[model samples]
Target: MNRIQQKKDYLKQSLSLLRDKFSNIPADKSVIHKVASPLRLEHAKGIVADAILKIMNDHNLQMLALLVNSCRSEVVKILNEYSEKYFKELKWAVIDEFGSVILKLNTNIATHNYLLPPLLDDLEESSESSDFYAKSTNYFSAINQNLLKIVIYHWRLFKNATEQGYLSASELILKSNVSQASVSNFIRYSLEKNYLLKHKIHNLYKFNNNCLEDLLEDWSFYYKNNYGKAIRFISYDTTYSIDTLLLKVKVLRDHNIRIAIGGFLALELQKLNYVSDIPDIRIYTDNIKYTKDELDLIEYQSQDDVTGRKIIELVSPKAEASIFSHIMNKDIPICDIIQCYLDVRHKASRGMEQADFIKKSVLL
Candidate 1:
């Protein structure tokens, strides 16, 4: 198909998908009708905006600028009779295509609605500490330590059951192993939190929205500001070998954070392809020798050099040395490392020791 026909087809598909997803809402009919017809005027504006985006991507910026100007002239003509609110809403669709285009035109665009006064008040009262681990622990503890585990388990079960087609209340109870009352409570909670939906016909539960994406985005922002510039204290061992460490490294990089690998894995990192892609990687191995080719095998890259910092290696005498001390000496924060260590220690002491320790810790 030609470019113009392709653009029209895409818009038709998008409108159809949106209507199908929102079939439950009564207002969706009006929304769908608006996209289907040019009576709203904004419908044509959306088409023009989409076409401009295609041209922008296919051609040079200079050519795109001219095309945008031509489209803007036509858009202004169509929007002349529309009110500011209607125009503003139409501008949102335009901004979605080319953010710079909207900004260049100097349109008064408000992307997100402002938070309610109560929410703003709560946020203001919350402490503004750069220590993410401490803040996360405090937030999770306030809710209850086991809440995350329960939520994650339910979330996984909901996803798995949905993929398999449908699930019954009995199936949910069996998979989660929670009391009937608790299951009902979690279902209500998930609905309120916009995490899960109920399929009425199938009588099954499924993820309502992309909660995982939001969770990962939240963590990414938290880690970037808190630990991106710091040297990480990794407890590497035979169990946590180079392969396992590489997975963690990829996760950190995916979140656009830079970390210097420290501990036993540092030697193993130097023996792999850590340098060719992740040249900023600094290995803190105790006199381990590696060839340049081995260093060249590491495959990782920073999203941007703006947040990148040079890596420094600190040699330690023991294999399992106090890596935290070295990190502290370097003036890098170690709250995340400390919290991780404590978490591991708690998990290891899981029987009566855990119960006794928890009681003592809480009592104190």
Candidate 2:
């Protein structure tokens, strides 16, 4: 069979084993809430375990098979009309593994596909309380920058929560700007690596015992490690004096060019006690033609490696704006402290030493 069929078969087998357990599932609202809790997928496992029990006892397993395939929504609609009105109250769902998630779906994302369900329902619920999931912790990854941005937006959520040990997939979806399936994958990674714990809450997750300091340290490490693709030198030119550099800046500015001084030059312009023999004249800009033609830059074919003291032009690897609100030398506009710090972090002979000094002196 194809990959989708193979996955389907795997899901069926897992469901069949649990088919008989649902026969005596408790009907009490409290028990049902615990079993069908949308906060975490684990709680939904009870539904599947009960599904297996009910399926085995019945001769007509057609409906049960559909529910087993993650098609919970359709099953719920069908259950509503079934002769047994009690079935309407039954929360039938499937619990299986897809990527890092132990999926608990009472419904498939769609009837045509056999994949996991979307977290739209939970998303609606999240609109009611956005702060519950963000205060104590934030999710950031070296592998995904978009997800990192989403986490950054919600980082404050963790700080506000005095005791937030459980996070649901829906909260994660909204917080991370990721889809339900993506949230499941990341949760699986967090759980397996022990960053989060699968707690008592049905669909919620718990911490795996790492203390606050350790968690913060790991996040810091990931941030620095994945600050992502190093500085890119798109074009460069040789100019010997600070006066010429200022003139070039004036030219770019006169032409309505958006540019900002960065790297060691920014440090020097800031009047910080930074010592450098070959101070880099770095400028961030959207337009490269003006500088390349205006300054007569010798094209350096190598994109990964190139340097120039007179002038170097770069565009952000992620298309981030070159915000130059800070003015360092009265007339010369400079990039923000963070941008300047990164620009020289890995460049020049004494770049690291300067970066350290800049970080402690300005950024700290």
Candidate 3:
């Protein structure tokens, strides 16, 4: 029922599934690694897919192993596709019996020199190499919270700038609330990654105008992996509709509850509508549990229990700073263009089309 309990339940279920499948694997051949999903919900799929992709590229890791839980088929497929397309020499073993992975390195195929020291230690300590099941704990280890905030600050400046206005490094550090050392480090990293170009004008070090699209995506991905945990529920009442949900949300807002609309419903309210059916409503707040109590929402025992029912998702943005920048629409607060776009970009329901429209019509 609570966040910690839900996580414990998920880990227990996951480990039980893994043990049954790997029981026959030679003790010498199999290793078990314990991992926690970034999101609290078990049915919240693809939480680790992006992490896995980043690890493989960052560490030049090879020989991926997969344990295919019935619920994780989509994530497994994505890992398989990415590995095949990028690393032709990489190996994949999808164990159907165990819904987990064991990373058994084949020294003959994998190069010893490519194995990074820190990663090797983590693997050795865990005695597991199943990249699919293991948490990519260090995926965003190098990125700082201030770095992301600085990027977002620049993005806001770019959006409002009437002309090519460049800020000096010192000014950037002062306005973005970051340390001088962090700004220096960010300048170095951005230049190296080709995200920004530096120019010297009138003895001032200024950065060239670089589009924040890629940087924003990176920020969103990092935020999702680290902070985007949500408490979701489905209504047992079949008569409750999207319109009804909006009315209730408006009531919560009237009571001074700091709630903002997000996801599909937010997009529709912002007039960037592309999807025909509103599958669910996403609400962003600082304290979801408190808000849920205010809204009198019930937590469903299982997703299967309420098939074809209206769902409500309550997410608390745990980022150091607020990314929503929400606008009040007809007494209802809704997330900004960037937040709405990022929220629905990966959804199954025409999410790409909606995101494209926002880019062309608003962001571009």
CA-lDDT, candidates in order: 0.32, 0.45, 0.52
- For model 3, residues 71-178, the per-residue Cα lDDT tens digits are 233334454465556544344333311122322234244321111111112232333433322333232333344444444446555745633344567876776565
Q: Each candidate's TM vs. the true structure? A: 0.27, 0.37, 0.51
Model 1: lDDT to the true structure: 0.32
lDDT of 2 by residue, 1-364 (tens): 3334444445454444443443432222212111132233343444544554464555333233322212233233343344133342233333323211122223322222122321111233354233322311234432233432233223333534534645677876765455786577666655543445565547676543322222333343333444454233333444345777667787787777777677777777777536656444666665766655665455545734454434355543332321443334446767655556666666656876876787566433
TM-score of 1: 0.27
lDDT of 1 by residue, 1-364 (tens): 4433333334333433433433422231222211212223366667545534543454322111111201332333444334243333232221111111211222453322111111011222324322321232232231221232334434544544544544455676665454676456555544543445677877776653344333322222332233323232223222434454456444443443333344223322323221223322334333222211222222224434223332222222221222222232222222122222222222222322432342233211
Give the best candidate by lDDT.
3
After aligning candidate 2 to the native by TM-score, how far in Å is the CA of 302 from where it should be? 8.3
**Whole-structure CA lDDT of model 3:** 0.52
- Look at candidate 1 and give me any clashing residue pairs: 273-297, 273-298, 274-298
The predicted structure with the larger lDDT, 1 or 3, is 3
- Per-candidate total of colliding backbone pairs: 3, 28, 2
